[model samples]
Structures are given as C-alpha cells and as structure tokens.
Target: MSYTIKPWQDLTIQDDYMFKLVMRRKPICKRMLEKILHVPIRDIRYSDDEKTMKFQYEGKGIRLDVYVADDKGTVYDIEMQVRKPSDDGLYLRTRYYQSMIDMGLLEEGADYDELNPSYIIFICPFEPFDKGRHIYTFRNVCLEDTSLELRDGATKIFLSSVGTADDVTPDVKRFLEYVNGILSNDAFVQEIDQEIKRVKKLEEERVRYMTYAMKMQEERKEGIKEGREAMQHEMQHDLALKMLKDHKPIHEIVRYTELTENQIRKIAAENSNVSFGEESGRNV
Candidate 1:
C-alpha cells in the first residue's frame, strides 16, 4: 500500500468533511443561508446533520453536508459538492435528493400538499455550467406556455465557486470566494475561519478527523480492489462468450477462462443460435 501525506495547515473551506462540520452550527448556517439566499431567514434548526442517505442497505449513499430547516417548515439540504467535470450525474442527483427529502417530510399517509417547501442547494467548488454566473436557480416551468408556471414549491440552486458574474450579491460572492479557498476579510467568512480553527484545536474533532482520513484511505483502496475485480470478471465473461461461440466444451472453457461451468452454460444458453450474423454468446 502506498501512502500520501496531506497538508494539515492548508485545509480550506472546500474540504467536504470540514465544511460539513462547520455548517452544522446554527449561527454559521443561518448566516450562510441569509447571505447566499439573500433572504431574511428565520431561526435555523438541524433535525439531522450530514446524515448519510441511501435507498437500501449496502447501496451507495450520499453524505449530505447540512440538512436543516427554517422555522417556517422549509427544508434545506445544503450540499458542498466536490467538483468533478467528469461526472455528468449531478443534475439527476439533485432530482433524487429532492425526491428523497420530500419522501421523508411527512407521515406515510399524509397528502402530497403536506410536503414542505424544499431547497436542494449545491455549492460546487468548480464552475458546473461553465458560465460566468455565480448562481443558477431552477424550478419546474411549463414549456408549452411561456407565461404558465408549474409552482411545484421546490427550488434547486447551484452556486459556483469560480463564477465571475454579479448575478449573486457581494456577500454571496464573498462566501463563494471563501469556499474557493481564497482568504477573505468578510465578517461571515472570518467567522467560518475562526470556527474551523476552533474545531481543529479540539482534541475530539482532531481525533475524528484523523480517523476519517484513515477510513477514506481504506475506502479508496477498497474501491480500487472492487474495480479490478469487476474488470477481471468482465474479461473472463468476454473470453467465455468467444469460447462458447466456437463450441468449446464447458470444462475446457472453465479451465482456460476461469468461469464456472454453470456460468458458461448460462452464457451459451442466452446466445446459442447466431442467426443474424452476430456472436452466438453474450458477453455478460
């Protein structure tokens, strides 16, 4: 196993776990919503903070940064999204988050109208849309009639760290700059920095951070191991398919391709007749 040392002193606002911890504080979180949202937000309360949400056991889950609500019953899922231009799944991800949030809002038999007004705000450290606009807000709208509105009571906002436009308020821009790792003199940003420093000074938080880093490393290694195993499985299946097409015996296919006899038979059964001038065996 290889090791890489992380710089402790330079840990910035973009660090996912650290940012999550900082946002769990009510004052900091309330100020953040007020600044970026440009609204007089009432008292903020977190029912659950950074809760790992999943559809099923053993399924991939997302660790939400700040899951809180205002006094008026408006649910907010503030996410500090780690930027990745390579993954094109974020748009659907927001949709999924919105659905999950709504599902958890009310009792099982409650009417749909009982759902709270929800916001899934994603703070992306990288410019997502490649536009210069700092903030992008979306809601359901009618495409047939320009004047018609869906008014679904759900809002999805995306905040980009690298945006240069004046679409957002100056305070919002300052917060974005702080999230982008630029040193800031803004009062709210300074408060965030101070809280981060205090959190770092805590013996408990420090120990947790160390353990979190070790867990992250292990997860990374496990992910690499899973990827390699998947690749090898795919290769073996591909070879089994070719051998099946050539009418190779199952025992020989199993010996040479590392596939079980049942698997090889199943693959052959799926694609035994090559009528359309195609390979007779399925790759999977």
Candidate 2:
C-alpha cells in the first residue's frame, strides 16, 4: 500500500525492483560486491531466477530479492531490506536463507564439498545491531577457542548506511548514501544510477513492479489479520477451559467466552472431574 501511495518517480535505489534491475548488470553487481566484500569480483553471473525467485517449504514461501554466483563458484544473496524485520530478527532470517540457498545448490548425489561458498548480505538503512558499526560479518567459530573456525564456507554480512564509525571505505559509504537517495559522483554508483533511470523508463517493467507490490501488500496484511484472529481464538479457548474447571454455569461460560452452547457443553463434558463434582453436589 505504501508503495502505491508513494510516487512512481520517487522510487529509490533500494526499492526491490530497482535493486534487482540495477544489479542485473554484471559490471554493476561485480563492483558492488567488490565494495561490500573488499575483494575483486573478476566475473559474476546472475542466477537464472535473477528477477524473481521463490523458496517454499511446508506451504510457506519466501521471495529472494537478488541471488547470484561468481566465476569462482561463490554464491551471494544480496538483499536490500528497506523495512527492518521484527526485533532485528533479520539475522535469524539470514540463517534460514542460507539453508534454503544451500538446499538449491547441490544435485541429487552431489558431494558436500561441492557446495559453493555462500555470502548472505543484507543492506539495511539502519543499524541491525545496537552496536555502532557500518559492517557486521558473522561466521561460526568455536566458543572455547575463539581462534578456531568452523570452516563451513558461509558468511553473513549486515551493512548499515548511517554508521558514524570510520570503518567503511569512501566508495562503500557513497554507495550506501546512494541507496539512501543521496546522489553520488562515484563511478560505480553513477553506473547504478544510470541503470535506475533506464529501468524507470520501461513502462512494462514499471507496471509489473506495481502489480507485484500490490499483491505482496495484500498477502502481508491478510497474514497479519489471520494471525490476530487465531490469537483471539486461542485466548477464548483457554478461558472456556478454565471456566469449565471452575464449574461455572454453561450459559455464563458461553456468554463470557462467546462460545456456542454446544461448544461449551462439549468442553464441560470433556472435563469429567468437574462433572463428578457437580454430581456430588446434586447428591448432597
């Protein structure tokens, strides 16, 4: 809904479609990765599902923002997260993403060693950690010996745009600024900006993006509404059970718990201990 309310011309570099379109250019993606990882990306290939990808398990779906693999067999999931997920839970989501990507990389009988190295990168406008740093890189290490590495060939990186620390390079800072909508003179960022303009000019692409945005918004709001309704139902069920234990009158229980007469009777019948007490009272 917000995307619809926002002007089409006001779309930022961090907008999901814009992010994908700009990064689809190999040169731009390679440069961006070089800046983020501080290593040269000689050549990189966008995944076949570069624009849109779905990872679903157990009837739940997650759409990957941008996915790619470099010439050296290193895989990257670069996501521009405009909204901070609940309670900075993005880290846990990254863990889930790493597993999902790993599941897709190997064939039926592929060796474990054949699994390509992965980097799960999240570019956020705000600090993911409360700590003041532009970049946070995570890898599994031994708790007893900090020097010991798990060597699992996986890394998760979170980069914030508003960090005040002196840790990021000028180009990195400029790129982050550009993502935040501050115009940049940096060459790599300039190329990205040009691509953004080109993408905005595509009438068909813009229409597709608008449609996808509305569909996702509806799904998200529906999920939230369903979650609230389920929670209320659970609360009512708990209260009904407690009223049954307390030997409350069936009609009173139905009135307070908003349950049907038959449902209240069923709950009261389920608690046979309460029935025994009622029978003893009737005998007395």
Off by over 4 Å in 2: 1-4, 48-60, 86-88, 106-114, 247-284
Show the lowest summed lDDT stretch of 10 residues, model 1: 274-283
- Candidate 1 TM-score versus the reference: 0.86
Q: Please write out the lDDT profile of model 2 over residues 1-284, one tens digit for every residue.
A: 23243555677887776787777788888888998898987798777654333455444556677788888989899998888888747878998788777777764354678888999999999878878788899999999998999998999999998887888899998888887788879987888888888888989977977777788778878988888998998898789888767767666777888988777667657666653135324410
Give residue 211's lDDT in candidate 1 (0 to 100).
85
Checking candidate 1 for backbone clashes, the offending pairs are none
| lDDT tens readout by residue for model 1, 76-170 | 89888886646678888898888777666654354697777889999998878888889999888888986887877899999998988878877
lDDT of 1 at 213: 81
Worst 10 residues of 2 by lDDT: 275-284
Per-prediction TM-score to the true structure, in the order listed: 0.86, 0.80
- For model 1, the local distance difference test gives 0.79
